[model samples]
Target: MNIYIIIPAHNEEDCIALMLESLVNQTLLPKKVVVVNDHSTDNTQLIIDGFSSKNNWLESISIQSSKEHIPGSKVINAFYKGFETLDKNYDIICKFDADIILPKNYLESLVALFNTDSKVGIAGGLAYINKGNQWIYETIASKNHVRGPFKAYRKECFQDIGGLKASIGWDSMDVMLAQYYGWVVKTDKLLKVKHLKPTGKTYHKSSKYLQGEALYKMRSGLPLTILSALKSAISKRSFLYFKNTVLGYIKSKNKNIEPLVTVEQGKFIRKLRWEGVRKKIKI
Candidate 1:
C-alpha cells in the first residue's frame, strides 16, 4: 500500500530540513511527502522548496488560503488541504510536525501495523523530547489529543471522520472522532522518535494545550468525554496521570487556571469543568 505524509509547517525552517532528511532515510519510505507551507514569512517555504526540487519523493505546496489564517483553524485547514491534494491511491496518510525527527524504522513499523491489523484505523508511535530519557506521555496525550510526532491514519478512516474539526482542539478532535466512530487507534511504544526542543518561544505553551482540551471537551460533549478521560487516567499510571485528570476536573470551579498548567496541574478544576452543567461551548 502506498503511504503519504503531510507536514503542516509555519516558520519552522530550522527543524523542517532535519525531518525531511529522516523521511529520505525511512526504511519504508512514504510514496510521497507533502509539506504545507502556511504563509510563513521566514525561509521555511524556501527550505521545503529546495528539498522538493532535489528529491523526487518530496513535493511542497504553498498554501496561503484565508480560511487557514485563524488560530486553530490554520492547522485543520492545512491538514485538509494536504488530504485533498495527496494522491488518492495512497492507502495511509500521516500527519506530523516539521520539527520532529523520525527513527529510521518509523515508517516501517507503521506500515507493518496497518498491514497486519485490518481493524486498525490509526497507529501512533512514541514521541520524546530532545534526547531526554523522559517520555512526555501525558503531555503528548493531552496536546495532540493522542500520541504526537508519529500519527498515521488510514485514508478511508480519515475520510469517514469528515477530516478534522476546525476548532480549538484540532489534534485531539481528530483522535477522539476516530474513537467515536469505532476506529481502532493504537500506540506503538517500541517505535520511538525525537521532537527537537524548540528554540525561542513555542506555541506549545501549557495554557494553550489545556485551553484546547477544555474547548475540545466542551464542544464534543463533556460528560462522555470526561468518562473516557477518567478511563485513560485509570488505565495509564493510575496514580500520576489518571488521578491528575480527575483532580484537574474538580479544581476548575474555583478560578481561572494558569498557563503551563496541564490537566495534572489543576486536576480538580479540569474534572469540574468536564462535569459542569454549563459546559457547552460559546461559538
Candidate 2:
C-alpha cells in the first residue's frame, strides 16, 4: 500500500531532525512526506531541508501564520497546505507531529493491520510521553482513541469524514465521524511512539475555552457536553478547566457558531456518547 505523510510543524526546530531520522529508518518507508513549516521562527526549515537533500520522498513548505501556538486549527491548516502539493493517489494518509519518534516497524506494523482488516478505517499507535526518564502512556485520553499526534487513516476513511475539523476536538471528531460512516477505528498498543513534547502545552491559554466550544460545535448537547467537561477536568485534575469548558460551550452557543456535523451525524454522536456514559455506570 502506498503511504503518504504530512507533518505540521511550528517552531519545532529541536525535534524535527530526530523525527525525520526515525522516518528515514522506517521498515516500511512512506512514499512521500511533506512537512508544512507553519510560520516557524526557529531553525525548523533548515532541518527539513537537510533531510530533504538526502531523502527523495521528503519535502517541506513554509507558511506565515500567527505566532501564537493556537493548536488544532493551525495544525490542520498547515496539513492542508502540504496536502495541496501531493497527489490524491494514496492508500493511507498520515498526519504526524514534528516532535515524535516512531519505532522502525511503526509504519510496517500499521500497514500490516490495515491489510488484515479491510473495514478498518483509522488506525495508529499509543503515545508515550516523557515522565521521569520513562516514557509512559499518555493516559489523559482513552487507549481506544488514536491520539492526534500519530494518526494514520485509510484513504477512504479520511475522505468519508470530510477530512479533519479545524477546531479543538478535531482529533476526537475524526474518530466519531469515522464510526458514523461505519468505519472501524483501532489503536495498536504494540506500536507505541515516543512523544517528545506533551500535548496541550503549546496551546494558547486563551484557547482553553475552545475545548468546550468544540463539544458544542459537535452537537454534543447539554448533557453530553456537561459530562464531557467534567470528565476532562477530572482527567487533568483541574476544576478551572471544568469551569472554562462550560463557559466556552455557552459562549459558543451565544455566538451561534456553526456546527461541525450534520443533524443526522450529531444524532449518532449523541448516541455514541450516551453509550459510553452508560458503560461506565454499569461497570
Candidate 3:
C-alpha cells in the first residue's frame, strides 16, 4: 500500500527531529512525508530542512497560523496546507504529530492490519508516555481509541467521512463517522509509539472549553455530554475540567453554534454512544 503522511508542527523544535528520524527509519517507509511547519518561531524549520535535504521522500512546507495552541483548527488547517501539495494517489493517509517516535515497523504493521481486514477504515498503534523509568500506556483515552497523534486512515474511508473536521474533536468525530459509514476502527496494542510529550501539555487557556464545545457540536446532547465530561474529569483527576466542559457545552448551546454532524448523523452518533455506555455498564 502506498502511504502518505502529513505532520502539522508548531514550535516543535524540541521533538520534531526525533519524529522525522523515526519515520525515515521505518521498515515500511511512507511514499511521501510532508511536514507542515505551522508558524514556528523556533528552529523547527532548520531541522525539517536538514532532513528534507538528505531524503527524497521527505519535504517541508510553512504555514502561518495562530500560536495560541488551540486544539483542533490550528493543526488541521496546517495539515491542509501540506495536503494541498499532494496528489490523491495514496492508499493510506496519516496525520501524525511532531512529538511522536514510532517503532520501525509501525507503518508496516498498520499496513498488515489493513491487508488482513477489508472493513478496517482506520488503524494505528497505541501511544505510550515515559514515566520515571518505564513507558506506560497513555490513559487519556480508551485503549480502543487510536489517538489523534498517530492516526492512519484508509483512503476510501477518509474520503467517505468527508475528511477531518477543523474542530477540537476531529479525531473522535472521524472515528464515529467512519463507523456510521460501516467501517471498522482498529488499534494494535503491540505497536507502541513513544509519545515524547503528554497530550494537552501545551494547550492554551482558551482551549479549556473546546472539548465541551466539541461535544456540543457533535450533537452528543446534554446527558451524553455530562457522562463524557465526567469520564474525562475522572481520567485527568481534575474537577475544573469537568466544570469547564459542562459550562462550555451550555455556552455553545445558548449561542446556537453550528453542529459538526447533520440531524440524521447526530441521531446515529447518540445511539452509538448509548450503546457503548450500555455495554460498559453491562461489563
Candidate 4:
C-alpha cells in the first residue's frame, strides 16, 4: 500500500524528533510525509527541517495560525494545509500528531489489517501514555476507538465521509460517519504507540465547552448529549466537564449552530450511539 502521512505540529520541539525518527525507521515506510509547522515560536521547525534535509520523503510546510492551543478546528485546519501539498495517489492517508512515537511495525501492521479486510475503512493502534514509569492505555475513550492523535484512513472511506470535520467532535464524528457509510473501524491493541504528550495538555480553558458543542453539532440530541457528557465526566472524574458540557450544548442550541451531519446522517448516528449504550449495559 502506498501510505502517506501528514503531521500537524505546533510547539512540539520536545517530542517531534522522536515521532519523525520512528516514522523514518518504520518497517514499512510511508511513501511521503508532510509536517505542517503551524505558528511555532520554538525550535519545532528547526527539528523538522533537520529531518527533512536528511530524508527526501519527509518535508515541512509552515502556516500562520493562532498560537492558542484549541482543539479540532485549529489542528484540522493545519492538517488541510499539509494535505493540500500531497497528491491524491495514496492508498492510506494518516493524520498523525507530532508527539507520538509509533512502533516500528505500526505502518506494516496497518497495511496487513487493510489487506486482510476490504471493508476496513479506518485502522489504527491504541495510544499508551507514560504515567509514573509505566506506559498505560489512555482512558479518555474506549479501547475500540482510534484516538484522534493517530488515525489512518483508507482512501475510499475517507472520501465517503467527506474527509474529517473541522469541529470539536471531528475525531468521534469521523468514526461515526465511517460506520454510517458501512465502513469498518478497526483498532489493534497489540500495536501500542507511545504518546509523548498526554491529550489536551495544552488546551485553553475556553475550549472546555467545545465537547458539548461537538455533541450538539453531531446532532446527538439532548438526551444523548447529556448521557455522553455524564459518561465523560465520570470517566475523567471531573464534574466541571459535565457542567460545562451541558452548558455548551444549551448554548449551541440557543444559537442554533449548524450541524456537521445531515438529518439522515444524524438519525443514523443517534441510532448507532443508542445501540452502543444499550449493548454496554446489556439492555
Tell me the TM-score of each prediction against the true structure. 0.69, 0.98, 0.98, 0.99
lDDT of 4 by residue, 140-187 (tens): 888899999999999999999999998888999999999999999998
Candidate 3, superposed: residue stretches over 4 Å from native:
none
Candidate 4 Cα misplacement greater than 4 A, ranges = none
Overall lDDT per candidate, in order of appearance: 0.65, 0.92, 0.94, 0.94
Give the C-alpha miss distance for residue 123 in model 3, angstroms: 0.5
What TM-score does candidate 1 get on C-alpha atoms? 0.69
- Model 1 stretches astray by more than 4 angstroms: 65-71, 131-139, 142-145, 197-201, 204-283
**Candidate 1 lDDT over residue span 130-224, tens digit each:** 43566444343433224534678898788766666564455554665565567777766776677775321353433323432444333423454
After superposition on all CA atoms, what RMSD does each candidate show versus the true structure? Answer: 9.3, 0.9, 0.9, 0.7
Model 3 / residue 97 / CA error / Å: 0.4
